[model samples]
Target: MMMNHCGLLTERKEAVPLKSIEVQLEVKDHVATVVSTLNYENKEDKPIEAVFVFPLPGDAAVCHFSAQIGQKHIVAEVKDKQQAKEEYDHALSSGQQAFLLEGSEEISDIFSLKVGSLPPGESASIGLEYVTELAVQADDGLRFCLPAVLNPRYQPQGSESPSVQVTSVPASLVPYSLSFSVQVSSPHAISKVESSCSLEPLQYLNTDQTQATVKLAAGHKFDRDIELLIYYKDAHQPTAVVEAGQASAKPGSLMGDPVVMVSLYPEFPQSVMSSHTSCGEFVFLIDRSGSMGCRMNQKRPQETRISSARDTLLLLLKSLPMGCYFNIYSFGSTFEHIFPKSMEYNEMTMEEALRKVEKMKDDLGGTDILQPLQHIYSQPCIPSHPRQLFVFTDGEVGNTKEVIDLVKKNSGSHRCFSFGIGEGASSALINGIAKEGGGHAQFITGTDRMQPKVMQSLKFALQPSVEDISVSWDLPKGVSATILSPPITTLFQGQRSLIYAQLTGKSSETTEGSVTVKFSFEGHPSKNQLHFSLKPAEDSGLTVHRLAARTVICSLELEWKPNGQQNEEIKKKVVELSVQSGVSSFFTAFIAINKDSPESVQGPLRCRIIPTPLYRAYIDSQVRQCSGKIYCPPSGPLIVL
Candidate 1:
């Protein structure tokens, strides 16, 4: 049974400790720094501990966490995950207040925060800051999302463990309030800032129109995620930013060397772009889990995710080149294939697939995508016809890292194009597989027509694959460069590729440096170059350095193995880098202890779980009536107190 007050799921209804959240965003070109402050007050008579699970963008680097308890201030320190957990447990056993924030072991985007030993009527404020690179949309705008919903991830039976335990209620019933504001600055004029939610009018801060401020409209209900599309006048122009190293860090280290972030927008020649390859293999993987029966968004309650996916699949099937090979696969607790093997695209095959797709239902019990993926990858790829795999899902899978690793292992034979079908989809799953599989990722949400985005990706698939990509650097004598990010493997027309590099040694402030990217597309070689000053931008706050560190850490993590001597060394390096850079990783956590408490309270600490808002569609579809009351099904129960 759901409680009326904020729809909390508890044996005994009580006031939620979380009261309000305030967010501040600073955008410099395509990178953003977000600082969120959460205010909490213990209204219970005895001491209590609260646990909250939340979502963050998969690529973000959390750099700061602090807490203010009454008049005492404590700043968290990044430490080894086990050590941090031990410290937090010890503090709690000693009757001292403590806080522990950790990233999910299985999923990168899911995080859990524990606020322990809050005294009765005492108030605390938490501050969390992170920096991330904004993803470029199919259009020229940059996209930034603040995820407020944590949908339950479906765990297959016999899996190791669930990523995170999420307690969710309807969006309209969330208790806390949110205040969000953004300040944007760029090299070019800010054309506009659009959001899926309501927002106040944009306010330009400077006469040049390069600086602006905007805020969310008052009284916004915490429902779907907040998405902002920021547009600039010259969005396609290539640029680079060099950030100085931290002065306190030791030299010759990652944090000590100056880092440069280069943004490249590759433009294919009209002749090459106009021609599309007619010979290739296209495989479409669709999700038919029970949650797919839910509506796509609040505005279109009649349009369910399966329906939209079906319509998009129809368009994709009709658009295939005549000579291409194709197949269709759908997965849930089990999987089905339209054809036993890849077949030539023709009228008969197309019609058969269309008829079967129309009759598909969302009766599958849970999301178990690994088996289907293994089956697809096991098939021998047809020679002379490149394979392109298209995966469409609401992104509810629990084995994200394993799936992404499998894709990376099989990437040589196929390129994967991924589509996230609805709100609260796992960005880590969608983006990770696409990035590892050497293709593109797209998110469809909030009245978005899946046709356009899917069609765009198909166009990318049909384009001639780029090859022989290489990067070169030009710098003054005695100055060298070290590449930090993984090498660029795929390039599309008008798509942006970001490169991060470290500059070692020193050069004059007036010295200049340049980088050139060369690649072969459609049998034609092309190059793009950007030149910039050696001097770092003043007061840049080292955003580039942190982002570069995250890039290197992710690459290192992917190289790690479960039971290898080399993997242990790799894990140690990741921990050291994460600690030195103050960035969150799979092996480290942020821990804070309140040492200056006035007194130790003598009482048993009650445990409370702050429920995040569930998607309205899930509430409608998953809840079942039983014996005059409504309850969620046992197959995938998301409501837990």
Candidate 2:
């Protein structure tokens, strides 16, 4: 038997062990801290081992994991991934209670948790906490998402699959319940908070409107991801936050030193913005995999992903400047191109492409984007015409790292604009390729109009590029700065650019510092500066420090080479940093063991897979329903965690 929910796959037909979940979210300005408590009970007659796989934001830093049974509580410790696995296995084999949580090696957003040796009739409460920076949307609203829908990733031939087999069932059949609430505070007055899921009225906690609280409306089925768009009074204003270091950590370390996070929204001159460039090459890549035939959302069952992509392509084709060059490519197991080379944009070529795009269907077998990308990069560039690549997909590819690395390798030749089509699209893949290629990434989900967002990116592509970007800091006499984030290579008008820096040495609380960002736009030089106080914010948690650490860790992970020596060194550094900062990484995991129980349980253990909810479209046609349960014949060997 096969069962699935939230990317979790189980091999047994027994009832799920998970019962309910409660979440608390606290937002301070642009960063958010989330804590989730999951309640589980083993009702079977024998001891069982339960495993669960789930999704999280790609950029989040998991800082805490703990478990409580009755009056006893156990806090997990971050350790090397291999070491943690060994310890967990030993505890399970010895009939002791243990818990382990680890991130996927291939995919950063997916994680697996194991509950070992849970005696029958026993109950446990698991706590998970993470911190992440919210992304700013085109309309200046900060976006916060709790990922609940994860579709199965399509692994290409000759690629090794991750330990978990991700599958899905209809959302209506999910047995678990969820409750969520949020407390938001910012320096600027809260304009409003909106969500794709139903939300209660926003209540102001203070007269100034700087503090507010909100909750998710009742009867929210886990059919789609929970997305919250938060708007502040002054959304585009440049701001800086300084957070103090951890007292228990060693000085001069990432966690021990104060970190400053600066948010910049660059403004271009009106003269340059008024004129859109007419001489550039635009390339569009569309995903035509079998899954593209699925409905975009449960709300709109008639509009499939392929149909939406087709409509968006029409808008893009119609909006292009007449003097520019463009082409279209669609891929699945195989790839095809509309033109042998990029053709000049004109009436004849535009109409020809439109006719072919309208005939496009989801006939492709699987999502294999690397081949078309490689072929695109192999072509020669058109002189005097910069290249901008627009990618449209549902983002179910498995080899995310390889695809992102390929884009980065050829980043100098072109800019990439990526769009994720549906709820379960891979954020890591969509954001990584765009970030590495120095362009923008957008997600279209839940009643969103694809044309507006695609056209916004088209406008960005038409805008003149920003060049000669540099960041400089003016600090107190004794203090020096070590930049943690990669240098800023791409900047768009009115887009947010985040910089993280570690402040070393000492300075008086009364001192002040300033940062200036200088860049060239359309052959004209311009700069923006923001002055901030040296004193760290009172009651500010280690959110900034953790975020900075995650930024650094991501950069280091990208630097990994296939050769042994460099890869080993990079792994060592990541493990050390991950352990020191208490942040989960690809090289490390969180493990907890209950030592209070003096005696081993006298029984053999059975393994139970905890079911999770997913969108109905995620399942393949081979799935059959019988007696209100979903089942599928094994496609391949089930790789248990």
Candidate 3:
């Protein structure tokens, strides 16, 4: 079951005031003892007398605690395990100044600490020490949870007074599950088991997942291996699932579109197919112009974009298959390769590549990408494997069409992916080039999440399912199609073939028919056939495998750019269709919004949250994506409505 972080929000009917209550913790470990101290604070000046509850991990058994307020400090220690009950009984007894309550403890079970009156402008702290033999076991991990009561202890005050507010602590920042583990029979068995480990509070900064330090013993490979699939839920709502994919998005979509994807494995079904093994050659066309200096780490410790690209290249070298080949080419006013040509993997080559990547720093001058793409295009030594060309720059080139045309010409043999660095870079031009090259385009938001997508793009480009796939659909009579997951043959190895499209003109009765898909692969038959049944599309849960196959040609044509007048007409149709379908677009929304005079809202009180209908729809989709572990942050913090 998915877990939710819960919160309580209270507002005064008359007075415009709010109160927040929170708890924080610090932990220390010495020898066999684990000491945990919690700090509780009431943000509002009003007195807060609510019970604060915390959870201890299942293994640890509480020994005693230290409590204090002003000059009253009390420490309780039990000489024997049986005598621990006395300490708790004494704490529950109220005192003149303050009182404490203790609960029973069990091996590795969660225990709660309750704090009663934390007055406004006043705070309290308490400490607990526990012992656990599990700490010495192989997986030395720790986790803790704390929950607060909002307005738990309240007198019948006027309704205008502020009530206590509580929020679920940020799970990623909270202390939980420090380690994870999985063990398989063999390296190959790793794929079969597809071990999954969960890490708590994965949302915090400075958190990292690493392979454990322990090594395989002499007789067998490491007894324990761990892979983490962290799921975090915000307390404000139910748990959700958020998916990530690298597909090109419809135009005008928010740059922060949530990617919805799932893991799969077809070949070697025994292996857990969370990730794909990929191979491709990386050709880095770097820009070293003077205007580009601001992009490099110039005087700062942070490496510039060019340096970042090089560093990313080094990381790719380390992560990609050992057989993958790569070449580095840098450009400014001129073009040059760090190596004479593409080189295969080896310790010496990696060292040389790393050194060269580091030295090819910021060289200020005009930016020109054509020269390098042309230079590489001119080379006869291009690797025979699936070729991937990565152009990294600030996107200030003179003639974008020239690059686009050049990319289109060579894309039959290579997929050219472009990266636009910095905020001012040209999105349209980079996107255009990628579309023409039959590759994907991505903007480097920042250096942090760069390598994951970059590597994925290369992998996708290299392992395309079927090249030049063609489709044609003709209904038996009065039939039409509304394309959904359009036909694209860049399918990965382990993922399923999820083809979706909408159909119109069918009766309430089922329709019978077949659709065809044709495509050619290198050294294969001139064409291959894929036939499927045509299902009548409905407004609800319609499966369009047939329509998807029929509309593959239209989806291909979606990439075509028309001449001046024709282009305008096509753009108009795209805008109209996109709006009517409720799909986002790069070209349509502007026309719709500008043509209408939107109604305005003016009042002392306004709806600050998104409409419940839309918010729930989006959240519902997210809940399905992350397998109930992720939660969509509610519109509480957004003022869309």
lDDT of every model, 2 decimals: 0.82, 0.82, 0.38
User: Rank order by TM-score, top first?
Assistant: 2, 1, 3
Predicted structure 3: lDDT = 0.38
lDDT of 1 at 142: 89
In angstroms, give how far residue 13 of model 2 lies from its true place: 8.4
CA lDDT, candidate 3, residue 374: 82
What tens-digit string does per-residue lDDT give for candidate 1 at 144-252? 9887655567766666854344455665666677889999999999999999889999999899999999999997766557889999998999998888899999998
Lowest lDDT 10-residue stretch of candidate 3: 610-619
Q: Estimate the overall C-alpha local distance difference test score of candidate 2.
A: 0.82
Error of 3 at 267 (Å): 7.9
> Estimated TM-score per prediction?
0.93, 0.94, 0.40
**Candidate 3: where is the Cα deviation over 4 Å?**
1-281, 290-292, 295-303, 319-325, 381-383, 396-402, 420-432, 440-443, 461-465, 468-479, 482-489, 494-502, 511-641
Tell me the RMSD of model 2 versus the true structure. Answer: 3.9
